[model samples]
Target: MNIKTQLKNFYLLQCGQFVSQLGSKITSYGLILWTYDNSGSVLSIALLTICTLIPSILLSFLAGSISDKWDKKNIMIISDSIAAFFSLIVLILLITNSLKIEYIYIINFILGVVDAFQNPASEVAISLIISKENYIRVSGIRSLSNSCITIFYPILSTTIYAFAGLKLIIFIDLATFIFAVLTLIFLVKIPKRIYNTGDNTNILHQCKIGIKYIVNDKGILSLILFMAFVNLIASIYNCNLQPMILSRNGNNKFQLGIVTATIGIAGVIGSILVTIKKESKKKIPVILNIMMFSFSICNTLLGIGRNYYIWTIAVFLGNVLVPFLTANVEFIMRNKVPLEMQGVVFSARNTLQYISIPIGYLLGGVLADKVFEPNVYKISFLTNIVGSGKGAGIALIYIVIGIIGFLGCCIFKLNNDMRNLDN
Candidate 1:
């Protein structure tokens, strides 16, 4: 099929996925609120993130190979179905008032496993359906959708939770999942799957193919390593962001909603810019530069700011640059990775790039609760710098993470291998 016709189908698929994504985000935000309200621990929230990441990291090798061998559409449909089933379980637990922190962790881990298979299939499906020239544009649209979700979910969830509670959010999530699955089955059309006869049947060998592909390419390997390091720093910042806002804001959901909305608005603006601009030649450098500025500016403000106003500005500016960074990265991946190997390679990419995230989540929580928060007052000078408050330790952490992230980007920019990815 022609690119235009394929794009029409892609848009229909996106619309379905968009609804699903929004519902998922709403559920996520509601859970965060529920978790924090009940536990009042940063560690609790960080553990939630770790639960999701660890399963994906552990199952990534197998998931990628399976995705490559299986039908992408079926994989997606099955994955979504499994996820919906788990959401139902969560709803049942909540209704029974039996949902506990441990249960949440288990549910999240299962969802992560589902995502491990689903994400690579979804990525491969997009690559198959969309032409190469439109990679960046499509990435922008994806980013735009995610940003829109980010902008609204906090507000929606907060309002919904206040009025109706978490049960209603889960209902919306289930409804969206149904819509997405139906759209995939009925409305969307993916190109026929083309199997590579040369592909080995051994699952182990198939999994190794992706690893070997990256390892053999020093430039791509270095790029992935750089991202891994960046994720480490980002994970810390992310794990703490909600806790910091809530702790410092007296657990005001509206403040959190407003700040989160600003981030989405910034992302929308950034996505628009990426969609309209011509692709750049120096993608690696662009990625590194954007990361450096984003971490430096956003983290700094977040650390220093005591109010939602500053938080809004910090996130807005930081997120505005994210779409450009992601667009360039996706553009490079599409140009460099062969379509037949994309599923595995992309999975390998995820495993390597996100491996540090679990560690970051764990460390961020420990440091916030055990180390920083406890010692914030003892270290009078440090407390003076960041100011004494409920989230003082987390504030210090943001500053440190931002600096490390900035320096890490700078160091990676000096790597010749990363620069050569453009060639």
Candidate 2:
């Protein structure tokens, strides 16, 4: 198909993804708030995170394989259905005041299992069917969808929580899931993936092969590893922001919502830039170097930023580079991996990428609540002589991590193995 036609097809599916993400976000914060209200334990929150993420890490390869072996459209539709049904049950229980945190945990675990399949299927389908000229648009669409979640979720949840209560918001989220499933059913028609004629790998073998490929391919694996490391730090900063703000100036839930909306707005702006001008001229190393630097700077600023406005600005600018990095990484993975192997490869990559999130959250929770909270005064560096407890110590840590990210850029400059592929 021509580029225009491909763009049209890909965007239709993206709309469904957009709806899916919106509801997912609404349900997400509600659950988090519920946990805090019920137990007031960070450990409960951590368990919730582990429950949600463990499936993504373990089933990623398998999910990828199934997506490749089956009809891509059907995979999306089925996954959506699974998610919708689970949300509906939770919604009903919530409305009746029978919902428990355990219920939320169970449903989240199920959703994570489906997510493992849905992610690789949708991403690979875009690269498979869309013309290369329009891949940027696909990337833009994905980024925009994610941005919407960050942007609207806080406001939506708070508004719902105010008058209607959390129960009603769960119902709204259920509706979002249904809309997503119906959109997929009526609109998308993905092609079935076929293995190469000579390939004899079983499902188990296919899973292992993806890991082997990621490991053996030094260039791809290094890029993936570095991406994971950056993500780890980013997640930590995100999770700790609320505590840091609270510790510094007495944080409120309402203000946190606004902060999230700002971050989302920034990401959407970044996606627009990518749509207008995707990566074209620079080598991969150059792109990675810029992305890592930008992320490092953003995180460092967010860590140490005293004023709310400064943190908002830092997050906003941080997002601009994020889409740039995200689009290029997807571009690289799609182009380098074989069609038959795309599912498994992308899954393996996502598995590694997501592994950073739990680790990040753990680190953030620990530092903000325990390590930094008690010893904020003791951990102070000579440079932290002027700043507050949360501000200075956290800022010092961010500076250290930021320097680590920049050093990654320097290391990339020295590596020549991936230069030819990038060019």
Candidate 3:
């Protein structure tokens, strides 16, 4: 295909994915609202995230190999179909008033499993469709979709949930799922992978090849490790943000929604800049600098600010830098890795980078409940410094996370191996 034709195909695919993602996010937000309303425990929320992450991490190695060996389009369709089926199951349970919190956990786990295969396939498909030169711009456009979803889904879900109910929200999800599937089947065309006729490797061996590739590349290994640490801090920050705001605002979900919306707006702005701006030649510096600023500024503001206004500002600033960071990292990977190996290599990269997320979720939840929440009042200095309140302990945790994240950036910056990726 010509460049213009390829671009057209990718845009169509993005549109379909965008619609599907919006529906998924709507359901996700609705579920969070329901779960929090029922349990009122940070650990419960943490567990929900952990349930999803664990399966994705465990299955990633296999999923990557499968994506490389199988048809990417078929994999995505099957995954989406399975996810829709699960959503149907949830809907039935909700209608019958049998939907328990534990059931949601199960559903999330299944979705996570689907995502392991789906993600790698999707990444490789993008590589197939888009030329290398446009990787950064396309990444930014993808980020824009994500950001738009972030902004829209909360508003959409909250409204539907309030006026109609979770049933209606789920129904909308099903409709979007159908639209996405149809679009994929009819509107987009993904080029076939060019395989070597002599190469006959089992999926398991391909998985090893993926791992070996990363292990042998010191620059890629170090960069992935740095991201893993970043994920640790970022996950903790994400896990606590909702609960903290809810606690401080007397379970005012609107306040939380507003903060989230601000983040999306900022992300949209950032993504726009990333789309128009030239790709950075020094991607390592862009990645590291953005990480340092994001952690230092956003967390500190969130740690100190007691109201939604401050939360909005903090998230906005923090999220705006994220697209820049994300585009650079993606550019580095797409530029360095071969198209045929991306399915497996990207999957391996995900396994390493996201492995810490579950740990962060667990630690954040445990510390919030067992340690920080209980002891914030007792620490006179801490109480005096931040002022003890509903989310006082969580606030303290944010500051600590910020400090750790900044220090991580510094350490990564000094790594010769990671810096070499810039070349």
Candidate 4:
């Protein structure tokens, strides 16, 4: 396909994706609020996170292998269809007043499984459709889609939830799924899957080969390991964010929405800048490290500052640095990994990086409830700094995680393999 045709097709795909993501984000925020209000425990939110992540952690390798062998468009359509069906089921249960926390856990687990296939399929599809020269710009556009969802979903869902509640959110999600499915079926023409006759047909063997390919590459391997650590730290902050903000804001949904939206606005701005400027040809590592360091500092400020304005600014600045890091990393992957192996390779990368996420969620909750929240009274010196309150312990956790993340970035900077990856 010509470049213009390819761009047109990709934008269509992105439009469909953006609409679907917005709906999903709305549902997610609604569920988070419902679960927290109903259970009134951070652990409940953490369990929900675990249920959502565990499937992706377990099935990513198999999903990636399948993506390489199958039609990407069909995989996406089928996954979205299945997910939509489940969402509809949940909606029905909610309407009937039969929905429970366990139901939400089950639905999220199933959706995670769907994502195992859908994410790799989408990534590989982009690699196939777009020219290498546009990878950075396209990555920015992808970030913009997510940013738009983040920016709108929280406030929109919060407002809708106040009147229509969970059932309406699920219905909205189902509609978006239908829209995405139709777009894939009609508008997006995914290139045919490339098959290698010489390669083994065994799924296990293909997975092994994929792992070997990633591990044998020093640059990719180091980057993956570093990212795993980053995910761990970030996950901790994410798991506690809702509780922290709600605790500080007296559970005001509007206030929480505003704070979250600040991050999204920053993301939109960052994505626009990256899309316009593209990425630096050289100094990729320097850019990546600086962004990471900046993110850590912002995170630290978020932990230390109790004021709403401080919290919003910290979150905004932290998120603003994210697009640059994401675009650069994506560019590296697209350029370094062979097109044929992108599905499996990207899957493997995701699997490894996300392995720490569940651990982080579980640990964050346990530490917040069992350790930090209780111990704040005992440590007068520490309490003097972070203050004494309901969410203060979680705030302390953020500071520690931010420090660890900064140290990790420093270590990453010293990794010659990662620094030289794009060269």
Candidate 5:
């Protein structure tokens, strides 16, 4: 099949991804709230986030190397099946009334380990379906699909959990995974699963080769660093949004769900915009501006008060910039790397970009409970302008973080090297 046909073929995989991820988003938010409410310890929930990522860091190099060696299609199928089973097992635990914080950690950690394998394989497999020029389109579609889940999962999951239970949510997730698997069986068409052997070497050497590949690419490495800093800010924004809303004590699950899902809804909106936006290398600088300014504005508004409705509006707006930034960033990376080395390059990028996520989780949880919510009750000077709501007092950090993140993005424009690339 041609690349165009492959595009049609793999739409099912994207659909499957959407369903599986939607299930995950719902369960994860529910689990976060459950852990916090039961233990009243945001730190515990944050620790769950930290533990889940540890596996990805440790195993990513090997995962990237293996992605180059294996049948990409089979790898994804196995990964999906295992993850589906993981959700089912969690559902059983919920049914037995044995679910706990430790259980959440275990499940997420396993998913991370599985994802280490899945990410590189999926990236490479998509290339098999599409030619180089069109990978960005496929990726956009995939990102849009991801956004769809984000938009729907929280509201759907929270409402369902409210009426039924977490068990039902997990079951819904399982069903989605099964559907994804079946869809892949019928829709995705990978004609051959062969890797070039003219450059064959030892397995140990393959591992080292992957490592050396990223290490040697200065352009790739620098972009990875830039992303790490940006994502650190992003991670803080993410981990704090729920706690920020829930700080008032009366935050219903639905409110929390909307807060959680708003960014994704924005992403869905952003992805749609990408489809129509005229494609050009120059649009990238505009995207960076959007990232810097929108996030700055979001943090500024978030610090202004404890108004959930207001913050939701801010996040929804920020969502537009984020997906635009993300899609373009992926496009840049796809263009920079060679096919054979894309897995290692991409995984290495992820490893570096994700370095601060754990830190973000730890700091956000601890600070919200210990620092910001406690003594900073009347954070005077600037943020006190709207100091009327429950969380209005400690809004300075939000503005500070947002400003810092925006500045970081701005510096990207000042650098002549990155901007000169497509020229």
Candidate 6:
């Protein structure tokens, strides 16, 4: 296919995927609010997150291997269909007044398993369809879509939850799933990878080959490790943000939604900026480190700021730096990794990066509830620094994690292998 035709087809696929994601995010946000309201425990939230992460992490390698063996479009369609079916089941349970916390955990676990296959398939599919020159720009565009989803989803979901509750929200998700499936089946045609007839490698051997490829490349391996550390620190903020904001704001759903919307707007602005700028061929690591530093500073500000307005600005500023960092990292991987091996390699990379996330989530919750929240009131020294309040302990944790993130960046800067990955 010509470049023009290829770009057209690629974007058509993205449009369908984006619509499905929009619906999914709305339902996700609504469920989060419902879970938090009913449980009122940070640990409960942590458990939900753990259930999601563990399945994906465990299945990532297998999923990646499967993606390489199958048609990417078919894998995605199957994954989305399974997820939608489960969502419908949840909706039925809700309508019957039998929806429980256990059900959400079980459903999230299943979705995570399906996503393990879907994510790598989708990533590899993009590499198949788009030209190398467009990787960075396309990454930015994808980020922009995510930003738009974040921007609108919170506002819409909160409003819906207030009036109609989860039933209507879930129905919307089911419809979007069908739309996405139909689009893939009819509108988008994904090119398949051709394997060598003489090669006949088993899945386990292919998995090892993918691992060896990364291990032999010190630069890429170091970069992945650095990112794993960064993700570990960031996960704490992710798990706790809602609880902190809700605790400080009297558990007001509307206020939490506003903060989320503001952050999403910042993300949209960042994604737009990245899309507009000409792509740089060098100094990617330097630019990524700079963005990470800026992000760290924003997190620090969020921790120290007492006013809601200040918190909003901090959230906005922090999210604004995300797209640039994410796009550059994606560009590196897409450029460095071969198309055929991307499914396994990307899965391996994700497994390494994501392993720490659940650890961070579980620890963040435990530290906040068991250690920090109760003791912050008792510790005179901490109280004097972060100030005394309900959410003060969580705020302090954010500051510590932010500082740790900056330190991780500094370490990355000092690592010659990671810094020279693009070169």
The model with the greatest lDDT is: 3
Could you tell me how far off, in angstroms, the CA of residue 187 lies in candidate 2 after the best superposition? 1.8
Worst lDDT run of 10 residues, candidate 5, spans: 385-394
Q: How far does residue 243 in candidate 1 sit from its true spot (Å)?
A: 0.8
Q: What TM-score, over all chains together, does every model reach?
A: 0.98, 0.89, 0.98, 0.97, 0.92, 0.96
- For each candidate in the order shown, give its overall lDDT on alpha carbons: 0.89, 0.72, 0.90, 0.85, 0.73, 0.85
Report how far residue 302 has shifted in candidate 1, in Å: 0.5
Candidate 1 at residue 113, lDDT? 96
**Model 2 weakest 10-residue run by lDDT:** 190-199
Relative to the true structure, candidate 3 reaches a TM of 0.98
lDDT (0-100) at residue 32 of candidate 4?
88
- Per residue, candidate 5 scores C-alpha lDDT tens digits across 217-313 of 6555656777788778877676666666676536677787776688788887788877767776574576577777777788887777566787788
**Would you list the rank order by lDDT, best first?**
3, 1, 4, 6, 5, 2
lDDT of 4 by residue, 255-356 (tens): 888888888999999899888884587645745575576658777887888867888888887888788888877878888888877877888899999999
The worst-scoring run of ten residues by lDDT in candidate 6 lies at 192-201
List clashing residue pairs in candidate 3: none
Model 3: ten consecutive residues of lowest lDDT = 192-201
lDDT of 3 by residue, 266-383 (tens): 8999999999887677889999999899999999999989899999999998999899988888888888887778877888999999999999999999999999989999878987
User: Residues 36-135, candidate 2, lDDT per residue (tens digit)?
Assistant: 6686554466557767777977899888877767777787788888887887787788768898888778888888888888888787777667766666
Off by over 4 Å in 2: 39-43, 193-200, 246-249, 379-400
Residue pairs with backbone overlap in model 1: none
Error of 4 at 422 (Å): 3.4
